[model samples]
Target: GEEAARAAGAGDLNVLIGYDLRFWRELSALVGNPYLSDFFHRLRVQSWMCAVPHLRRAGDLRGRLWSGHCDLVEALAHRDGRAAHAIIAEYNADSLGLIERLAGERSG
Candidate 1:
């Protein structure tokens, strides 16, 4: 997880995207629900496709963009559900904000 985060920080977007997709897919699979896993896989891929252009346009790839992933891994490893939820919430909000800003910049 930390290695993937570092790769992302170093501007290796493909590595970051692949790591994220695999992480989420495996995590969803842990729920033991095939339908849910499939749904999440499709949703994650679509989201990544929508964000790819904006992600590529960004100059700096460091900082919060790839942060929290290691912490999330730790939280999940320790079975801290609340901490994991908070991390996911923050990550989602931060990512959405970045994408929206990038999209707005491109459009306007």
Candidate 2:
């Protein structure tokens, strides 16, 4: 899907690839740098926490189910590190809600 979409688009694709946690670490180092700050400002992010940590740390057993999706969506949605984190947070919360309804309770 990514290649197909890129082919259809005219602009050169700029792919940012890195482990979500690693990416967050890099962003953490950029806070004092003006260029990085400017980039985040462009992405409309107010805080570093929004994008970094896009992949929520899995909780017990149930949290494992939501981690990948939360990371992927957040990673793709925002250029800034903090937005990813926020999206992941939202995604994980929503996923937990769904699981609660479907599985009732995960005791084991």
Candidate 3:
């Protein structure tokens, strides 16, 4: 994830995509359920792909993304699984909201 942020910071979209894919893979592996993990992995990738154009148009998101991830990591580092889960849920909800808003802007 840090690598992805670095790539984005450097304005290297190609590298950023690669790093993002890797980050999702690593993230899914932590799910502890193969089927469920793969499902989420694919979903995240699809969501990311769909949001790319809109997100790019919205301008740089590295700071926002990095901060979200940092909060998640901080929760995990403290071994607070509940907090970590909440953070993940919040992050996902925020991302989905942004995607929906972007889609709306494009269509309307």
Candidate 4:
């Protein structure tokens, strides 16, 4: 999370978010189930794709996800599974909402 904050502070949003993807990929690797690991990898890629179009047009909002990442990292670092899950769920919901809003604006 500190790495991400540094990247963001350096004005490289791509690197900032890419750190998140890398973190998830590393985490997914820890899953003993190969199938679930593969699923998480795919989902991470999809999430990255979902952000691409908006990244160019709405980079300002990228900071919104940053704090969530910090909270998520703290939860995971403390081994608080429940808190981590809740934080991740909230992050996903926010991401989905942002994507939907961007899609609507593009279509309408």
**lDDT tens string, model 1, 6-84?**
7666777878888888888887998999999999999999998987777888866666375677888899999999999
Clashes per prediction?
A: 0, 7, 0, 0
> Which candidate tops lDDT?
1
Q: How close is candidate 1 to the true structure, as a TM-score?
A: 0.86
Q: What is the C-alpha lDDT of each candidate?
A: 0.82, 0.41, 0.69, 0.71
Candidate 3 lDDT tens digits, 1-108: 667767755655557777877776777787688898788778868867876777777665554342254556677779898998998788678767767776787788
Q: Residue 31 in model 3: shift from native, Å?
A: 3.0
- Each prediction's Cα RMSD? 1.7, 12.4, 3.2, 2.9
Q: Of the pair 2 and 4, which is ahead by TM-score?
A: 4
Give the least accurate 10-residue stretch of model 4, judged by summed lDDT.
58-67
Query: How many backbone overlaps does candidate 1 show?
Result: 0
Candidate ranking under lDDT, highest first, comes to 1, 4, 3, 2
Residue ranges of candidate 4 with Cα displaced over 4 Å: 5-11
Cα-based TM-score, every candidate? 0.86, 0.27, 0.66, 0.71
Native-to-model Cα distance after best TM-score fit, residue 35 in candidate 3, in Å: 2.6
Candidate 1 clash pair list:
none
lDDT (C-alpha) at residue 5 in model 3: 61
Per-residue lDDT tens digits for candidate 4, residues 1-108, read: 667656655646678668866777777777777788889888878877867767667656545444465777788889999999998788678767767777787788
